[model samples]
Target chain A: MIDFKQEQDGAVLYVDDEQNNINSFRSTFRKEFKVYSAINAVEALKNLKSYPDIKVIISDQRMPDVTGVEFFEKIRHIYPNKVRVILTGYSDIKAVIDAINKGQVYRYIDKPWNNDLVRLAIQDAMDLFDTRKNLSDKNESLQSAYNELDKFVYSVSHDLRSPLMSILGIANLAEVDVQDPKSLEYFQTIKGMVDKLDGYIHQIIDHYKGSQGKQFGDRIDFNKVVDEIIESIKYHPSAQGVKFQVNLEQSDSFLSNKMNVKTILSNLISNAFKYQREEETNKFVEVTGTITSEKAEIIVKDNGVGIKEDKKEEVFNMFYRAKQDETGTGLGLFIVSEAIEKLAGSIDLRSTFGKGTEIKLILPGTSE
Target chain B: MSDKLSIVIVDDNEIDLMIGERLLSRVDQSIALTKFNHSTEMLNWLQREDENSFTTNTIFLVDIYMPIFNGYYVAEQITQVFDAFDKKAIIYLVSATIEISDNRKLMLNSRVEGYIGKPVTVSLFKELIKKHG
Candidate 1:
């Protein structure tokens, strides 16, 4: 019912074995953009070679001798950046899935394609292809940067740790003779500073390691991971006098990365512990998980210094801290936000300023 | 000479070298585990030891995070020597923090025997011995 004219700047190729399909596509899309049609995969390949500017290819699945998936898989090696879409029937769902999993098809439209939706999907595919190409170039640069940084870390740690350890070792040896209060106090302060620097180095290593994998995902456990986190934070100085509550409604297993989920939880929990009221107020943290047909949800609620409603969105931004005295890298929440997005998830924040805050993460689950 | 496994580990960290020796000793107490806190000494020793003079079962466990000669460099050298001297030797890399995927790819790409994560517990060393034996 909806009308869509091809707004693709470059020429679009419609490859189908049916002659009627070629006519239908041309009539529907020729108003706003140039359309190219091929009755078979051979002609499509020829057209691809002839027209270098063809940015998108919409191919039908049920072609003679070769299916859309096979055709695109062959084309992918040659025109690696070309946007590919499959027009398949409802009966060919399994083949469509195979095409997607093999990375041949970008999107699949049912045989009775919605005219507007098909056009829009094709346009979106082109835009996505361009974005992926740019991202690939960026990834290459990041790879070099990662290697250089790793080498730098190894060198710096090797050069610095030895001298620092020797200095500290000699200082401890000398401490046996010194009995002055001020001298000992000064040595203690220097030792503290050195330890702090070492801790920062470890943090840098962890951050570098965490940022290395940009690939989307794998299977992740929610329950056992949550248990480990609770155990890790139970003895923290800030968590004193705070009761922890946990509730889970999912099958302890899910298909996602455990590290990304852990990152999100750790950030939220750290913030919760950091901003707790110092008075005789009842302090507690409640973590709950629920899985529905659509998505998995995690709610982290803490009785802490909640942000103002207006500042909730800004908190997720990098290096944006509400308190000037808060000693944090500020990259923690930013990394959390990035991880959530990479998983195709959304985060919602609710807070009552000066009372409490709650963060909810809704992530796509395995059911789809 | 066949009764004891004479192994040499090259790493800059005294703790890591000590730990490696301790772990390897658990596998075979008769094992003559020598530790080198410098890579140049390691490469020099390997060069001087002739194939017939040294035991064929000798292994070189090298750390990848050293200052001068890294595990990759040591691996390349050993492979070259194996070809030139017509001696068969195994090189295993150890590192604390390298990703498993990256380490696997590097080992496969460079034609090395294996890699073990650092803080190498005693059990892992035993497994290595069992597999290599």
Candidate 2:
């Protein structure tokens, strides 16, 4: 008896008014399923409460006190995940529909139960229960893993920036006391390298903060975010003679991830400002966007050193630089692409060799 | 106020302390500067301070991250010792990579003037000198 019960695939509760029927169900399917027998509605509730592992329930439709559909409906809220099946000899279509709608029944068994058919139904129900349980369990672990990665990335990037800052500080001091042109140039070269590394670390931090779902739902004010980024870039050397223009049409209620949007816009705008031609009068980056209830469309256009047609495809790849220069870390567009993926959005780029570059992005947002 | 300001620099890292000294010296060669690599030592020095040592023109630059007592603890101890002085020295919090928590603490502590991210630039040092030097 213990061996047969141990071989069972899943636990199920059988509810019927007849003692004879309960005895028969227990005898026939006891080998295949771990059957829990309950004679009346009250006992059925007791069995369900006692055996939390009860996944599928088979209850007779007609009873002395209550109907099977009624019993299933009563405990629907308490045992919401349980797979319910109604059994009855009298075929009542209305009752079966009601059972399916309110009681959330999985299947209907005829008045005279078939041993073979009932066994298959119970097996199928157990399979569905396992699937649902696994899915929810997987979701929890996935979320926690993402959170762990986010914190790890943030701390590591900040740690990397400390030493880089020291080198930068050391460079600043070296620049003042060193009189020779050769040594000054060497310090300038070292400073440039440190600056690039520092910028790369910043991108990593931004990417991690932007990806985590827990960081979402920050109301994005395009004009305000743009204003802040532009204000900051104005102090950088790349802002020289670059006219920054922002034109956004968005309502007050548009909701989206603020950090991702900032990452996307700043990288795009910074790229435009950094790669401009020597002709001072023609340098300008025009940022235009419109936010709707379902999506946001943005265009960043700049008259800068445009990407060559061959290099355009690889521009979004990590560490792929179109221009071999000391100004950029080659991570601006790569970070933008990562943020886009996190937002589940899309981006398009167009550029000519020496004329300019234009980038368009479509991002999802909600007015609520 | 005196013609030359007295600057106090505190950081646990030896290289950072040296760099701070050089940076502040380059800003104004005549300015009197003091450096401390430990927060406890700095606190002990404050305890030994007399009326003439604490002046209105005195400036303190404290590193935020350290070994035993972090920069905020140092700031708290300094406030306890010097908040009532007639010539209160202005304190500025400095960090290699500024953290968000540091910003919140800076806002809460009105004693801290502002946060400066390292490596500190010559222009930034010159700006501080122009303000209170």
Writing each residue's lDDT as its tens digit, candidate 2 over A1-368 gives 11145465668899999999988888888777788978899998988878777889999888899988888889888887788888877567578887687637888888688887898888888888888788889999999997888678756655677788888888889999899999999999999898777777777677666665455577887888889899889999989777778899986456778888898999998888888888657689999989875788999999888999988889999888867764677777888998898888999999987999999999988444
Predicted candidate 1 versus true structure: per-residue lDDT over B15-109, tens digit per residue: 66766676565557766677789888888976986776555465778877687887788778777766765444667887654344465556563
The residue pairs that clash in candidate 2, if any, are: A88-A111, A89-A111
The best candidate in terms of DockQ: 2
lDDT of each: 0.74, 0.81
RMSD of 2: 5.1
Query: Each candidate: RMSD to true structure?
Result: 11.8, 5.1
DockQ numbers for every candidate? Answer: 0.08, 0.52
Report residue A240 deviation for candidate 2 (angstroms). 2.0
Candidate 1 TM-score, C-alpha based = 0.49
| Candidate 1 docking class | incorrect
Q: Give the per-residue lDDT digits (tens) of candidate 2, residues B62-82.
A: 888888888888888777777
